[model samples]
Target chain A: MIRNEKKWLEARLEEWVGERLIAGDQAEAIRVYQGEKPERQWLSFFGLLVGVGALSVGIGTILVVSYNWERIPPVLRQLGFLLALAGVAEGMARSAGNRIAGPALGVIWVLLPLAGIGLWGQVYQLSGDAFTPLAVTLMLALPVVWIGRHASAAAAHALVFVWTIFVGVLEPGSWISMRGADALRTSWLAVVAVVLWAAMLHQTRRLSGPAVTLLLWMAFLVFMFTIAGNWTGFDIRHEGIHFVVAGALTMIFWVGEGVLGLSGRRVADVGWFATACFLYVLSFFHHGVGIGGGLETAGLYYAAVLSVAGVVCLARADMDEVAGAGGPHVARVLLALPWILSALLLGGDRHEAVGYLANFVLVVFCLYTMHSAVLRADRRRVNAAVFVLGLLMLTRIMDYFGSLLTSGSAFLVLGFLFLAMAYGLNRGRRHVLEQVERGGEA
Target chain B: MSGKWLRLTLVAQIIFFVAWAGVEEYGRANAVEFLLETRPVDPRDLLSGHYMTLRYTSLDPEGSVEGVRAAVRLEFEKEVTVDGRTWPVWHAVEKVEPGRVGDRSLSSTGGWADATVTGSRLDFGIDRFYFSEARKEELNSLRGGSFYVLATLGGDGTLRVKDLVWDREPPTP
Candidate 1:
């Protein structure tokens, strides 16, 4: 059973015992029959240890090959790698029913192809970009990932797959060159394509949970960096259109969760968190600080299409149904507000106004997240909201006292304020959680 | 996945690696050898470790070639002694139409190389020559010296680097 189902059953058992609908012993029996919480913790630790060991051995082998040991003949090195690969494959095949050994061997099995390719390049003195070998390795490893169905191997495959896409996109004279505004736009489009591909893989169950999670997290970090880049004056030419694309991408997770049923509650939570972060970062931009290049007609058209699609998706995704609460309509409004306001303010050349509007909307959204998290007893979301609040406080404090006090004094004051705020927030969080637990018991 | 299917996939993977290595080995064995004068552009690839980036003197654009794609026909100039090994040096003759190099007259059958014209430079894609880290300092000292790459031109227009000879000194194997 899924974790949610298990938690629901446990909660029901507690309520039944509280109401005397079932005895405490019966409740304990049901809990015991549930098989000790799936043993995921032990498995996760074991997987980590195995993953680290595999990585060390793989890197050591690659380094040995890279050393270009002149004493060993090239043919001998090639033969050794091929034999190692065969041995690993044989082990993986034989350990079919052993969970720990099977996945561990599968990790080695998937990595050997890349190492072999690297050795091949080394032995042949083949001089080319890393993209070719990486692409080839991913192709060769796909079958292993599919047939082995090992999460660790799948995670390794996903990492290399994402790396290959990045290398292909960013490498000079490949699919796209990493120069100028056009390159930036194309790179963002590639990221969007990969994220959509991952979602498709998840929907089809071809990618396991860990692999999909890693892909999504990497994509999220990339998105955050892009937004942070714009805020720091990297100056992407079509500023308005960039915002639209980002907003549309953020809306995709919500669409996946509500409309397509391709993602789960974690994905929806990510969507909300990303939207909050997108607005929070955009609030830092000052007037006349962005790209001054005239907007291209093609960019405007792209922006228009994206805006329409984003609106349609948001409208189709019932916020309350997806959030399992009543206040998510406010979240939906907050989501659309950025795209609309960005177009208006940026088109009017009132870029500073965007900062003001984003600040307001972000504060309101953080409060909403905090309230909703407390109601649902979601410590993660509550922590996220508190962190955002702390960031806001720091930004304001820096802005107000940056030039007024001496540098050392300002840092000292900031340090004390941070400690005090953290202490208060921790106590408040603990009190709220205690109340939640008491309510549950009662 | 069942053990039977797992075995099948593993076997397929082994076959793929073998075939890949075999094809590369065959290409190297059958390819025609020639030397091209080159200069070091950079060193090292992040993934593959230490290496040298080479730009072929014959394929340099020199602000003459126009358009995005250009095919350059090569003609063997003369035999030169590099590191006590005699290798035929090839130079670019003239720009010819793509896939029509054979019809145009050429001094020697050193094969043609396709290059991507980016601004005033052409990327022949056979530019990198990977070497061991022990030879890095030795190769770095010959950056501005005479450098010739002993390469093979495959029948299908693929060029592969076989060795790097610097200032008529044999490179470490």
Candidate 2:
């Protein structure tokens, strides 16, 4: 693709020179401007593979060592681990700024602390809970994260945090386990807030690339855990508190990052806030629709919350003046529109029809998403939009025609509908792309 | 960190870890050991790799009561055993929420204190027994027996599970 671009520019420059629109030297300068080498994505790709491979091997080694600790003699086992740690650490240090450093550091980043835990557990006969070792290991891994600033090190730190929480929750004797579920839920929210805050701080400080990457992943994981945990419908009353907290954090980060003109982080913040808001709106509708009931107080709350979200999204999309008419606003509206329509449709006591209305809204929303994707000339987004549209269709078919699975006519109808939609969407896509090309030409 | 600083940090980490493990071992060696009868509640912590769940009768401070309190404060009173040796034991139990549990540093280096049990359970913290993954099945089979958790109660109310004993024998290695 890059080579094609360079060739096209060279041809254009030649044409300009031929037309006497510019001097020969000017054309040469224009050619030179387009000649710089693009980034080597293969380096990054190899680094990722190496990182994953190292993690797998290191973890496998630990498990192997753990199962055979007694037969190897404590002294030999300890010496082996120490040697491994030292060798990896030294190699990682020497390989700094090299392609292999990312993976090598990842090996030590995970191994050293975990080896400490296993060593202490084996030597001290510390039983009943693994919390102490896990916590200590996590504490030890922090320096590696801060100093190494490699993706693997940051990933190891994030995994350690998750593992510590997992160990705490599993061991009833641990502090987190004894604190009860309410406290755990609250702590997850706290985790999200802290991580998000750290991410913003890292962005503001212009920290190392790996440090920034780590924070983003950490924040994303915590946010997902919080959302999934609450959505499981365990202790429904407490669910409200989680939604409120997550919603607030999302909005706060979104507005703050957006206003600061951190465009890269701003997009992520918007995504997080919009998803959270959508979930919050869904919470109100779930109970109403679950019981095959009408919109009660939950429906009203859903409308109010979604209305606020729609306003925010619309306003942000509007503020993006550079993208012209159908930019991010179309995407935001595509997200916010269905829920708004669903809320309005559920405003009446047509309780049984709520599911059908939701399905209708989803199908329409998906179609619009596909249309917007085509118009924006985003082939990836267009593909994704079509994929989601197909999924929604499959869901509808299954929901409405499950008993008709043995009927030939039902299968034929489903097949026909699928083909028709596929054909129409493809034609629409081609037309949109041609229009975009024509617009570019003009 | 640069090469020199990274090496220094590595050395520091090793020293810190050695000190932590050494101090913990010294504390355990000096701790007062008690043989508490334990009932095996479960066999393993599958998610956490290798472990055994242990339940002690003394873990319940409420003694089958229904009402839930905010917190329970426990203090040890010196008792003379049949052998005429003074031992610290939970003698006076006070359930308080308003203003009972406070920082009363009990011993040298503040190693001991009146332990507070959050909610109803008196968690002495020795609730799991670790083992190798290969021994999970072997250790799990030992759950259906009369066993005891030989624990060491540190002066600071810290409870450490020293060993899991069954049929008068501890597991090999």
DockQ (CA atoms), all models: 0.30, 0.19
**Pairs of residues clashing in candidate 1:** none
Model 2 stretches with alpha carbons more than 4 Å out: A1-84, A103-146, A149-204, A208-237, A244-257, A264-311, A314-330, A333-442, B31-34, B43-47, B59-116, B154-158, B167-173
Ten contiguous residues with the weakest lDDT in model 1 chain B: B99-108
Model number with the top DockQ: 1
> Model 2: per-residue lDDT, tens digit, B22-73?
7787777766664556676655333444666777664444533222233333
- Give the CA lDDT, 0 to 100, for residue A226 in model 2: 49
Q: Per-residue lDDT for A384-418 in model 1, tens only?
A: 77788778767867666644533344445555666
Which 10 consecutive positions of candidate 2 chain A have the poorest summed lDDT?
A233-242
In terms of TM-score, how similar is model 2 to the real structure? 0.52
